[model samples]
Target: MPAESNMSTHSDPQSSETAFLEMRDVVAGYGNTTVLHDINIGVENGQIACLIGPNGSGKSTLMKSIYGFADVKSGTITVNENDITGRSPQENLMAGMSYVLQDASVFPQMTVHENMLMGGYVFDDDSQAARRAEELYDEFPILGDIRNQNAGTLSGGQRRLLELARALMVDPEIMMLDEPSIGLEPRFIEDVFDRIKQLNNLGTTILLVEQNAQKGLSVADRGFVLASGEIKFTGTGTELLNNDEIGRLYLGG
Candidate 1:
């Protein structure tokens, strides 16, 4: 049995001051629609924090708000204690943050190597991008094997792997992945999660939104449950997994 956790309905603002990524009292949405209200969450450095909720629960909106895709009506978002509210996506990427959207993002016409190079477009020197791609290839040898193949020709799993590797070009301090396992085959799902753990082992902090609640919480260091755009439960991953109420309501027990 998993040990119990101090699951709280609301986050403690004072406790999150030192978090690597922190959002406080943030109310965000697209245009005039407010999707999130008084959202408060924190992710520690080198930790895998996951958000799991039902559809339309604003899980994606929360991520979008942090990555500058949604409008923040109030409050602040900080990374490494530096305020980054309202920063553009490009600015966030330059500041050691990378976001992988839920939708398929590979460029069909581009070769695997070319797609990898695109990930490093922010680099001032072309040689630097090449070097980074080589390093990633060493880490993900399968990508190296398919370097010459057009991205459109790759299988679903291959495209997913490419997306993950490409995002590593900058070696981001933190990576935000939304529904990474969605649309993947069972075999590929495990592979994706394994790579996620590997990345964490190599010092990349992760903030994830996954529809597979059990799988997501199983690997997460910390977990948050959002409903109706508000955080309803916060605890260690094991705690959330073991919580009877959580399992009954969210885990379909």
Candidate 2:
């Protein structure tokens, strides 16, 4: 394993004590290859926390580990004070967590309404799913206008919007977003960031893995820097952005 970055934690101790989501001393990875080392991070209720680092810094792997897609070698992951390490994705969803994957994840052949319905498939009743779909339509008018159109016909930004809308069908309390702004035009990228802010305002605790470090930190309540599969820094977003060494090393200052 590589040496961990020498950085101090700047998290508010009180906030961490009451954090709704937390990973403590985690070591995780894919089959037989450890990628994360003694990692720790936390997000208070309804706060937007961003993970920013160089490529292969275990950012996505942390999210994957939380969602049970990666193998956890040790440590614990918790939500609302409940242990959820190694829970299946479906179990996590039922526990009020939702994960929005990278790239376009909609069913391209399905109509907008169909794709939305699929998001609520976990509901036991089809009628409940339909009601949730209607609620999402009201929340996203563009989706309503194109409810019958094929998902593949939409532009990149629109498809991204659709993915976000579908993810909301469950009204998850905690949302994990992986590269929400990837492949988007400048205008669309700004729009997506605005949407993410809107979602956070509506009380969804957000854990974001973004390539746009500056923009991501701008919207984040807390920021974490991962290097060599370990946390190099943890602090309020502004602290990291303004810190001389952190800014020069990670934010391309």
Candidate 3:
């Protein structure tokens, strides 16, 4: 892994002692569609927990609920022990949470700096946001060097890195990443996962939804396998990885 970045704790270690975040029985979907059923998930203050499964397993749907993009019909979503279910994205940001979707989360026409500034939208002062952006850039030097460059021009891997950096502007405690490694080449996939593992090491509780099951589980401290909007298995990465049935079923043997 690259040098570890500063940890992003879900709660200020000096100020609180609570689980960073929690999603209890989250059921969400399109209008009357109800794709996610009784989904329960959590991310500890400084750990990486991943969800992996075949496509159409409500992975993205659950992510949307956590980020307040989709309506969570029945369940509680909390951050630092405060209820956040059904809150808007803006509200979630104010609560010190960040979300990075699989697509279009980055402003194509904006410079990397501009994109990071938007991450700190809750802040009213440009200088403070800029300083936070600079701190993020420092965490990802490859992104820092191109901070002023148009985000649309970056390579796929670079753009993903930019999104991760931008999500850190609030110095978020739990950074929910939806498909963090989507659409990247094999080499870059390793690079991205390495960075994610590094983020976990830095104490950022990451709740990741990934299509690449094998790779996602390899780096996770814990893993869940979702099927048809419900959790079918939950275990440490190694436990799931060693399960012969899981290896053959999801990891493609």
Candidate 4:
């Protein structure tokens, strides 16, 4: 059984020259080799901000660094004007932010509902955790229908959805998703994308790392193009799509 989380406070944000998340002059990577260099990004409140680039472009590395999974050599990561760089994973998780890593993210042996419980494990009250799980199930009915099924046995898309349900267990105001469409069949891809928007519509700011460029931009309110760990371009998703150079260079024009 998992404990209940305190999700009473949602992160209030400012959009005027203010970003809920900002990474400035960031240079980080594995032990000694740096993958991201002088990276800067800003995500405002209630938006789907996406990062897209070729493989090895440090997209995932940047995401991990923001979540405190990668090593940071220089820079700052802030959420809502508060400094949060180098915060431990649990620290970030408890600060109204949650992560749903690519596919293969859930506890394979746990029941669907059990996995939801695990997501809110940090909460101190068991009753609170239980209530949160019930709420998540209602938000995601697929999981509700298969609450007792082993998570490992669900289809690729179903598992991805379940991971999202778990992330909501803590009622996070921010979600960082990494390549969620991986291993999913084409038909359910749209559903996954739609759900991502639904999360944002409900007030969960999203920082997304997606491989499918066109699809990613379609849902993104803002987009960043990363090259060799540096931001090459930043604009509204529509602006990027309409740019002659950006379309030819990145969007399969």
Candidate 5:
């Protein structure tokens, strides 16, 4: 692994104690296959942290491991100082974490409003889900305008927005997004990123895995570089963006 850049902005040795989400010495992967080794990362509360790397660097695996989709061979994962290792996806959702996958995940046959309500299925009262959907629609008026339309009929950008809105129905404390900008036109990418910032500003911490390195780091409060299943660099967004080595090796400078 490359040496971490020396220009990090937050250098406190006790940062882990303050981190809202943390992974310590995690070794994880699919069954019978270990893809991550000794992974340690932390995302501060209410901050946007971006993970970037070349293809096949185990970015998606890390996210899956955190959300309990992948097996963790060893180590601990935590949120708000609560150990959450090996928690189920449903449990994680109930614990205030939401994950938006890299693939298109909308229920094609369902109407936009119905899909949004699905996100709040954990709610015991159906009326609560309905009210939450209305709150989301207010935040995303574009989704509200097409509330009755089938989700499959929406454009790429609109679909992405709906996915985001759906995830917000539960008002999660932290959201994990995998390649949120994928499969969209250049015009929609910026819009999606802007919404991400908006969500962060609204007090949701974010862990983002983005293929677009430069753009991802540009918006991140903190950045991590994962390569060959290990972390190679850790720094503030600006620190990584300006480092000559990172610029050459990862940012296509």
Candidate 6:
């Protein structure tokens, strides 16, 4: 079971409300390569926060740092009020955070059902994990339909769906998605975003890095613009979408 986190009292007074997840002056990198420079971002409880920027802007790196895959040289990362900086990935997961990376992270040789079982690896009880998998299958019926097929044999979109279904096994409070719409067809991309919205409606707070700025912002409550490892803009999704500078710079105006 994951720890029940407490909400932080310290917050930016200018903001309308306190955040559920916050990164304060975060300076993180991999090895000697500094990717995120003094990054500060936050996501409120049950809201979908989207990260958008040009390639190499460190959007993914910021998400990686939150997932504990990158090294934090300074600053702090807090979930609720817990300082989770420098924690291991497993530690973060146990603290009620779930991360889905940009790549196809499924076990290619395993059946879809088996791959989903891997998601609950953190839980000691096998029966509980199995129950969770069944619950996700009900939520994502396509996954249930092809549960016996080998993961590698599925289509690109199906694979992505499996990856998402697997991540839901833990019923995480905060779900960090890295480019969830990356390689799907137009219809499948719509489906993916729809799933994201549905998850948000079900009370999961989301933080995601997306290449499709227009669609990403459309589904998000808040949007962030990162450039060269720094935050350039922060506002409601509609505000950024309507900003001429943001549209010209990132939204393919």
> Which numbered prediction scores highest in TM-score against the true structure?
1
Off by over 4 Å in 5: 1-15
In model 2, the Cα lDDT at residue 82 comes to 90
Clash totals, every prediction: 0, 0, 1, 2, 0, 0
In the predicted model 5, the residue pairs found to clash are none
The count of backbone overlaps in candidate 6 is 0
Expressed as tens digits, the lDDT of each residue in 1-253 for candidate 5 is 2334354322322248888889988999998999999888888999999999999999999999999999999999999999999999999999889999999999999999989989999999989999999988888888999999999999999999999889998899999999999999999999999999999988899999999988899999989889889988788888788778888888898
Clashing pairs in 3: 7-202
lDDT of 6: 0.85
Candidate 1 runs further than 4 Å off: 1-5, 12-15
- CA RMSD of all predictions: 1.6, 3.7, 6.9, 8.8, 2.6, 6.5
Tens-digit lDDT track for model 2 on 1-253? 1212332553324235688998888899999999999987888998999999999899999999999999999998889999999999999988778899986799999999999999898999989989999987887888999999999899888898888888888899999999999999988999899889988888899999998899999999888988889988887777677777777778887
lDDT winner between candidates 4 and 6: 6
lDDT, each prediction: 0.92, 0.87, 0.79, 0.83, 0.89, 0.85
Q: In angstroms, what RMSD does candidate 3 have relative to the true structure?
A: 6.9
What would the per-residue lDDT of candidate 1 be over residues 55-139, giving only the tens digit for each residue? 9999999999999999999999999999999999999999888898999999999999999999999999999999999999999
Better of 2 and 6 by TM-score: 2
TM-score, one value per model = 0.97, 0.94, 0.88, 0.92, 0.95, 0.93
| lDDT digits (tens) for residues 126-188 of candidate 6 | 888889999988899999999999999998788888887788888999999999999888889
Worst 10 residues of 3 by lDDT: 2-11
91-161: candidate 3 lDDT, tens digit per residue: 77787788888885789999988998888878889999989887776778898899899999999999898
Is candidate 1 or 4 superior in lDDT? 1
Worst 10 residues of 2 by lDDT: 1-10
